[model samples]
Target: MLDNNLDTIINKTYIIDKTPLNEEKIKKVIISLKDSIISSKEEITAANAIDIKNHNGNIIDFSIIERIFKNINNEKIYYGNVTTLKKDNNKYYGKQYFDKGNVLIFNTGNPYIILEIFLKNFLAGNTSIIVTTNYAYGLNKLLETIIKTVLETNNLSPDFINLLTTDAPEELLKNNYANIDLVIALGNKSFQNKITNYSKVPVLLSGYETFDLYIDEMLDKTFLTKIINLHLPMHVYINKNLKIDLRGSMLVDGVEEAIMQINYNGNGYSSAIFTSNDDNAANFISKVKSKIVTVNTSPTIERLMDIQVKDLVLEKTVIYPNKKKN
Candidate 1:
């Protein structure tokens, strides 16, 4: 009776741990994610070798590590500091953390063993989507829209989007490439240099570059508060030389708050947008005004707006709004 009970418990644990993800469903997600990553110019690399040093202070050959590296090249090893560790009776059991190229390292007893199991399970169940862009602004809007669509369609958790962004090295790409079903490329000649030649997944060039928003105004507390409430995702690029006194959370939170405040103040709704270039900035602002909301025009805003509308409108024309009787 005792033996039977133990076996049952062991079987139950195995069943719980071994439950797989839906590969077909995950494949769609992975394709979308991969396209976004590629279009964004995010770097993707592969793992090369596994360094094994046993507790006896001797270099040991781990078959699992050998097998893992055998499929990948040596140039793609991710080197990073271990961020977390498991403790067995107060002693170190395993360690995990990000490496130099943002590669995650799990250097416990057998890192490859854990990694293999993880990859196997991840591939077996969930589909991974990779989006590569040159920068955050590259496919920011499109990717954001796609993410929202995915969330609404599948009822997936928003936290899954966080995995789409990482500073990890290319080594991890090898494990990923093995299970990926689709790859989407963005940009024309510029993106050609960004992708690898030997990807096993089916690659599709989606489209040309999309414009991103840019803000050049000095954002004050009041304005920041208004911007925050708008509920728009914007990438803030402060000048490297200009010292802006604001906490990271404050900046992120303030934009949402500011949008709300603007709506309440009856000064029209404001949505914060960001881009790396002036033209893209103008295009984004135009799109927002036409499709999103009536944007407040400042000197900086006026300049960008004018640049965008210059060819469409006659030059040196002044128009004024009619004052209404209260």
Candidate 2:
């Protein structure tokens, strides 16, 4: 019933530029986020209630994160060791070394913490540090803290740390190819094409997706509606079906909007779920009990399903409903 183009759906939403907040504002934001999430627990529980699980396969009441963030104080959560590095290039193979400190990486149900630790250790000896991830906002905050810590500890210039941005893996390789000593790559298959057959620096590839089970549970109803709306504009009925469109980015916004809506206690419903195939849809469906109906041909959906599924899951949300039937 919707007549809007994919372009309109994507353009209407803001992807990156959420206003910058100061420390006090940030605290308020966190509080608001926390309150919203906590308030939604009852609705989420009633919507798509499923048994929580852990690595050991035991049924858990709630995600470990709920306790970590919900109950713990911010100051306690931010506590970590401070490392001061005396400027010494000789100690680290002629690269000027700043401070080597340990920072805690929060668990979002992924190995990014491990990756961050590895990179921190790997870069400790070097004079400079560079971090790259699809999470530009998060990367910016992390870099800000690292810069602040380095400047405060060593009393040096603020520009000591450099930040760079690139659109794809090839761009990353092209810009920093031989210059990079250690590179940590996040997200799986999307970067494959961009990283394959390259003689670049060491690349650590983690799983293509990381699921926030808590957020997913909270956004279940919104997700169903958005998925239906997205395909509806194309005259597609995705009820336990798979729909593939080249306009995957458009769907990304819808998913994020769904999450923001649920997380912030807004009326908006968005998630980051989209795919070009059925297998991936099947995987998500199996996990979340949802369906999709697309107008795309079966063969086309099959071709892009896996990569699409992997990419979608990385941002959170399970794949669902593989193929649409005419």
Candidate 3:
């Protein structure tokens, strides 16, 4: 069972300070997590293998598994768009970085991608509760155990990292008055709406967010092929279960054709523009329905997150953004 003190723990978390000491402590916790992840990688990958074995409904390829391990590398937790400190707002007239609030993470993309989210909130000084739903027991428990050890080793409160393993997390996840302040969810459109309606709290949501490639009509076939090849693996590598749909693209025969193909096929999480013309890139971003519009780069979640903050961006996803290379 989950800790009985869940409400008590969450209620105490709202205050955050940017004082040097507090920042140092959060920094230490982050470094410890990074180090722990590095030291425990083999163990981590082994745990992932078990989740793969049990989740036979989803096609799990070796290349995909390898991609999972690589995405969990520690650096991603420290860098990218995530910022630990916001400039002081009062005196400096700038931003002050602080914890968002107590957070709940569940059923979002790949399990490993939470590494960054967990790190981000931890740095901001908010406690994060991770609930592993659908009962693929191995990876979830192993991660909880590893995190528990790290927290304990550092003399950090177990409250800092909490885990609940249940067959149905949505029951708990839906309860807004349940002490969770922010929810970062990755589900289909219906489920996303359900979370939005149920939670009075803020949500950094993916799923309803869409993506499509807007190619310049004048681009050469050689560059187009390269772009297509670059994006191809996004489908398989970034949680096929979540529908990154890298292989799904709208061939740019014309505007109607583009819209029809994407309507039928694209996942709409991360989108792209393969254009030498700056005007084309800008126009696509303005007209397209995607939250992330990458110009001259492959559509990956890492790149997406680099473009936007965590909750502001819920995808390239918890599976996170990556491509399986053979």
Candidate 4:
């Protein structure tokens, strides 16, 4: 259970996040974050080790963390304006979202996903509040601490990024007047539904997602073992229940079988097919409705979380009305 002061906490933080943001500060914060990760690899890995151990030895997906670093270096990290053309005659108004706003996130089981969202919010100039996934609370707390340390060292406010441990979102959601601008959630169907049912704010739901691998024909055990060792781990991360429980929730043989499995069962976030024939690979990639499509590749978490900073701004654009000289 969380503190009884959830409402007070949100109100206070919402005011802090409203502080004006500049790209120079955002860049410095990102640089500080990267340096902290580089300097704190041992701690981060050890923290993950504890979470994985406590949760029955399920592996922490490294690929996701790698993307956290990569995403920080995205070409648009320094982008400050949308460069929209001002209309003739009327007073032009242009406001950059990243400069001032707040975003709320409901994390799934993956810490990397939360980290990705944090970076996106930071780069876009908005404060982020993360409601940690209940199942991965300990690991998420470590992430919280890491972020705090980085922010403190960079002379940034810890309130710039916030975390809540309670699984009780209903309490906050019940308050219709909560000061929230955007909501993003990544989780299973139940998690998605919970947010949708209560969150009146604009929602970006990364719904219950999994991944599958299909072979052209039943391959030899040796080949199977090699691919599994290399790529099966990705499926583990994609599975809604973490790598331990539902890693293979959607492994099928043919395209038809995979389609039928999902139609009768559920959908995956991504699909990968390894085949000697290009046409077969193309066909498989074409048919699946997963957000990501890949052929002969590990549907790594790094790839799954690849997104631009502009995405946040697209959802909520700040309108600036500059005054012309009197």
Candidate 5:
């Protein structure tokens, strides 16, 4: 079944590459998708409920649903800010950004994060083939419907997003016939490693095996617990029990030690430090090696878009010498 769809999906992306989506149309599609999701909340929840039950009462499924609704509005903010290069000196130099074609997003059991990654690709005008496992069939089906309607209503290609629910995602990953330009895999180290090995194309990874939060000194145990609880559910770094069981939850000697631990052991996706001292926060934020460094605040759902931005598009630098015709 996937083999049959691969050609059509690749062809659709070729059409998009030739005739790119304008900013207005992109905005319209995003708006429609957000509205559709809001209107379909109850149905979405119901669909996710089945996934949860199938996964043996995985409460994380519900959390994914809620996060989607909570963060849907934030998608609008990403529009109108597509960066471009400015002409410099006598050289007509600038950069051009283009959408990657046919991104295969592998769902590692959480529909919400996959959906978030898909929208980032959508915003950048990339066509996506979202491969979901059987556990998330119901939720993904509903999302596929909602997104397709939005795209068609905006007079865009419905093939811009494709959802394939298979028990074995590796089959799709290993398929050489598909014109897959990139693969976005959201999972732990083992899952990411498998996808990386299976994919013929380059793989962009989100989520993490271990994420760290470093503290200079021990605070109230209650306060530390609150910090962990706030960031735990939103991230894959924590386990199902909601305990900060791994490397991220640790006490350090000082800001310097905290910075070193995070830089060495962290996944470079995100890291946070909670401190009232401006000097410590500044030092930590500046020195941390993660893509996102925050002080006195945990990473929020809004930052998810920021972290995944680089993986969504392709960039090229253009340079031309400006010479007067004589």
Candidate 6:
């Protein structure tokens, strides 16, 4: 149960310094977590296998294991050193600060995605309270145990990470908790609506929305088929032969149409365009309304990590006498 002591632990995060020493320490924790999971792969799989059997819903497969390591590798590269004072303008100086209170995260997906969110929040110097509303008995607990060990090993408080296995986390949300500065919910539309309806705290919704890929006829047909195959796992392909429909994604006549369709129907999360035409790529990237836009490649986890920091942090500007005497 999250208690007053957890609030104290969350309060302590405000004092975390943005020094190189601190940065290295956080990085070490991530690296150690990766190593620990790798060493215990067999045991971890066995534990989750029982969880799958008990769940009797969806089978927990090896893909989860791969995602665990993949998320670790993706996030370990972000050292979270964005806290520096800079000139906002000639008369003002600005600096970024992590949230002074705890971040309450409710997610139902590959359990390891919590690890990614935890690392992002932890590096930004905000404590996380993870409430897994799905099958929390297996991988969630295992991940929490390993993370607590890593935290203690690195001389950080184990309370830095809290994983609540309770199914009804909305109960916790109903309280007027002063320490909860942010709430991030990752799941389907129904799940997101549940969180939004209950959470008085601000909510950032992620996951569950289908990512659309707009193929322009300017590209060669063979390359389009290859790209579709490469992205098969992420997108819903109506045809195995690569005849992608609007359900998965529709072929557009030009970049303008692609931009229009995506802007009108996209989830405003992340969007990408695979085009060799520099003008087309530039036009699509500039016109698309999604938060993260990329050219010739998909947005990476590193990009998400960068944006996560922005989401969890606030910018402070201190106006002063003009240094240039303007």
lDDT of 1 by residue, 9-71 (tens): 223323332122243444455455434434533221111111112111112224433443333
lDDT of 5 by residue, 20-105 (tens): 47767776676778778879888987887887777622433455555654565455432224444556557776666677677888
The Cα error of candidate 1 at residue 250, in Å, is 18
How accurate locally is residue 157 in candidate 6, as Cα lDDT from 0 to 100?
A: 75
- Cα deviation in Å at residue 46, candidate 2? 35
* Among all candidates shown, the one with the greatest TM-score: 4
Give the Å error, residue 249, model 6. 15
Off by over 4 Å in 2: 1-161, 175-179, 208-326
Give the TM-score of each candidate. Answer: 0.22, 0.30, 0.59, 0.75, 0.67, 0.62
* Pairs of colliding residues, candidate 3: 87-95, 110-318, 110-319, 210-268, 211-268, 301-316, 317-320
Q: Model 4: runs farther than 4 Å from truth?
A: 3-5, 17-20, 56-64, 75-95, 98-100, 167-177, 188-190, 207-210, 220-253, 263-268, 275-280, 314-326
Clashes of 4: 5
Candidate 1 deviant stretches above 4 angstroms? 1-169, 175-179, 183-213, 218-220, 223-234, 237-326
* Model 2 TM-score on a 0 to 1 scale: 0.30
In angstroms, how far off is 244's CA in candidate 2? Answer: 13
The lDDT per prediction is: 0.30, 0.30, 0.51, 0.61, 0.64, 0.61
The lDDT, on a scale of 0 to 1, for candidate 2 is 0.30
Cα error, candidate 1, residue 25 (Å): 13
Q: Give the TM-score of candidate 1.
A: 0.22
Local error of candidate 1 at residue 242 (angstroms)? 11
Each model's backbone clash number: 58, 24, 7, 5, 1, 0
Q: How does model 5 fare in lDDT?
A: 0.64
1 or 6, greater by TM-score: 6
Worst 10 residues of 6 by lDDT: 231-240
